[model samples]
Target: MEYRVLLAESDRSMLERLCQVVDDTPNFTLAAKFQNVSDALGQGAVFNPNLILLDIEQPGGMGLVDAFKKVYPAASILCMGDKWQAESASGSIKAGAKGYIIKPFSGVELQESVDAFSRLGSDGSAEILVFFSPKGKSGKTTLIANLAMSLARKSGEPVGIIDADLQFGDMAVFFNLAAQTTIVEAVRDIRFLSPASLSSYYMPVAPNVSVLCGTRTPNMIDKVAIDKLENLIAMSRGLFRYILIDVPAGFNPTSIAAAEASNTTFLVSMINGAYEIDHMKRALHIFRDWEDMENRAKVIFTRVEPCDAQARLELSQKLGYPVTEIIPNDYAIVSDAADKGKMATDIRPDSPLSRQVDRLADNIIGRKHRIRWAGV
Candidate 1:
C-alpha cells in the first residue's frame, strides 16, 4: 500500500533533497511540505498523511514535536534537526514521533526510517516498550532486564534497553558493567545519531541485547528533558527491533512522558502490599486519561509468591483488568542472576519461572502455534 507523507523542514534545499529521495522510494509519496510549525498545524487533519517529516526547530517559536501530535494524530512523525539543536528530537518523540533522524543523515538513513514505519501493522506496531512503576522496590529494573532478554531470545531480534531511572537506576549493577555512555550523552549529539552511531552508545549484554544505562548522579537527570527522552526512544526504534524503557518510580513529568511515548506501558506491581495495589489503581486512573492508553495499558503482576494467590485474585477482580502475566517470586534465581550479570532465563532455562517468562514473550510476539490434544 502507498503511504501519503507530509514533510516539514525549515531548510528548503534539504527538504527538496529529502523529497527527491522519498519520490525515488517505492510505496511512499510526499503529500505536502511545510516550512514552519504554524503552517503545518494550520493545515490540520486535512493533509491527512500517513507519515510526517518534522523539523525540531521550526518557525512560530513553538516546538514542531508538540504541534504534530495535536495536528496529526494518525500520522507517524519522523523528526530531524541539527546536532546542537537536536535536543528537541526527544521532545518530538514524546509528542508522538514514530522515529527520529539526526541532521547530516544520509538518504539511506531516511529510507530506513520510512521503511520501519511502513512495516508497522494497521494496529500500529510497538517498536518502543516502556515499563514503569509508581512505587519503589517494585522490581522495575528486574522486569526491564528480564523482558529485554525475553524479547531478544524469542524474537531473535536486537533489543535496546534504556534505564531511564536516572537517579537510582541499577541496570549497570545488574549487568555488572560500569556505564560509560548514557541517554544524556546520546541526546547531546542527537544530530549525529544514525543507525551506525546508535550502536556506539549502546552497551551490548548479549548478541541481540544492548543497554543504555542511566546517569550515576541524580543531578545528571536534569540535563535530560522530556523531549530528549522521546527522541532517544524514537531513534532507538529505528535501530532495534524493540526498545524497552525502565522508568523511575513516580508520576513526574519524565515518567509521564515515557508512559505517553511508549507503545505499551507495563505497570509492574506485587500482590503482597496494599500500598502497591492502591498505587497501581491510582496509576491506572491516571493513565486511563492518557491519549495512548485506549489500547496500551497493561498491568503485569510481578514477584508473585505462591501464598499470595488470594490477593492476586482479589487484585485482578478489583481492578477489573486481566493481569497480563504473573512472574513468580524466585528471589534465589533472580538475585543470583542479577549478581552475575546474567539473564535468569539463561541461568535457569528449565525452571518453571523461566517457562512463565517464555510464555510472556510468546504473548508479546503474538504468534500462532498448533496445539495437540491427547484426548478430546
Candidate 2:
C-alpha cells in the first residue's frame, strides 16, 4: 500500500532533505509539509496522512501529536529530533507518536521505524491489574513484582509492570534493575510511541516480564499528568498480555487514574493494626462506582497473622467484601528476597508466600476453581 507521509520540521534545509527522501522512496508519498505545527494540524486531517515525521521539540509540536491522534487514530506518528532527548522523547510518546528518531537520517531508517508498526500486529488489549493500598507499607510493590513473575510463568505470556507509584516506586530496586527509561519518560513520550517502540523503554527483569520504572526524581511525579497516564496504560495494553501497575497509596490523581483504568483493582492491606480493615473499607467506598466493582475488585490482606478462617471471616464481615487472598506474615523470607532483589518465584518456589501469590495469579487468570485455603 502507498503510505501517505507528512513531514514537519522547523529546519528548512533538513525539512527539504526529508521531503526528497519521502518523494524518492517507493510505496511512500509526501502528502504535505507545513511551516509549523499549527498549519500541519489545520491541514493534517484533510490529507489523512498515514505517516508523520514531526519535530517534537518545536512549539506546538507536542500538541500536534494529540491533534493527529484525535483526527487520525490509525496514522503512525514519528517524532523527529536533532538529537535523542530521552526525557522529552517520552513526552512525545505520550502525545501519541509511534516513535522518535534522530534526524539527518536516510529513507531506510524512517522506513524501518515506520514499518515496525506492521510487525507489531493489531494493537491487542491486555488484562490490567492495579495494586493499591489506602496506606503505604503494605508491601504492594513486592506483591506486584512477584505476581508479575508468577503470571508470566503460568500463562506463558508477556507481562508488563508500570510502576505508577512515582514518588517512591521501588520495583526497579526490588527487581534488581537499574534506572534506565522509566514510566515517567514513557508517559511523556507515549504519543510518539508504537507497541514496538514502547517496548524499548522497559527494563526486562525476567523472561516475558518487563518493568517500567517510576520517575527517578521523586518530585517529577508531579509532572506525570493523569490523562497522559490513561493514555500510557491504554497504549501499553496493546503490547502485553497482562499489565500490572503498582500505584501510590491513598486516593491521589495517579492512583485514581490507574485504578479507574484497571480491569482488576486489588485493594491491598497489610494487617499491621486493628484498624486495617477500616482502611480497606474507606478504599472500597471510593471504588463503589466501578463497573461490576464487586467482581473486578479484590481485597488482599497481606502479612495476615493467624491467617485462619476466623480471621478471614471477621475481616470479611467488617469490610463487607470477601477476603480475596491472604498472604501470611513471612517477614524473613520477604525481606531476604527484597534485599536480594529476587522475585518470590525465584527465591523460594515452594514457600508458602510464593504458593499463595501463585494461587492469586491463577485466580486472576480465571482458569481455575476458587482456591481452598490451606492452613496458614
lDDT: which candidate is best?
A: 2
Off by over 4 Å in 2: 1-123, 367-376
How would you encode candidate 2's per-residue C-alpha lDDT over 1-376 as one tens digit per residue? 6789888888888889889998988889999997577777777778888888888767776777787677668788888777645445556755666666767677776676665444333333467899999999998888998899999899777799999998999888897788679887887887666555677898888888988898887999877898888878876765677899999899998888888788788999898877888888888988888769877788999998787668778778888788888887888898898888787667899988898899888876663234532331
Query: What are the candidates' C-alpha RMSDs?
Result: 8.1, 8.1
Q: Model 1, residue 186: what's the lDDT?
A: 80
Reference-based lDDT, residue 105, model 1 = 56
RMSD of 2: 8.1
lDDT of all predictions? 0.72, 0.79
Candidate 1's clash total is 3
lDDT for predicted candidate 2 compared with the true structure: 0.79
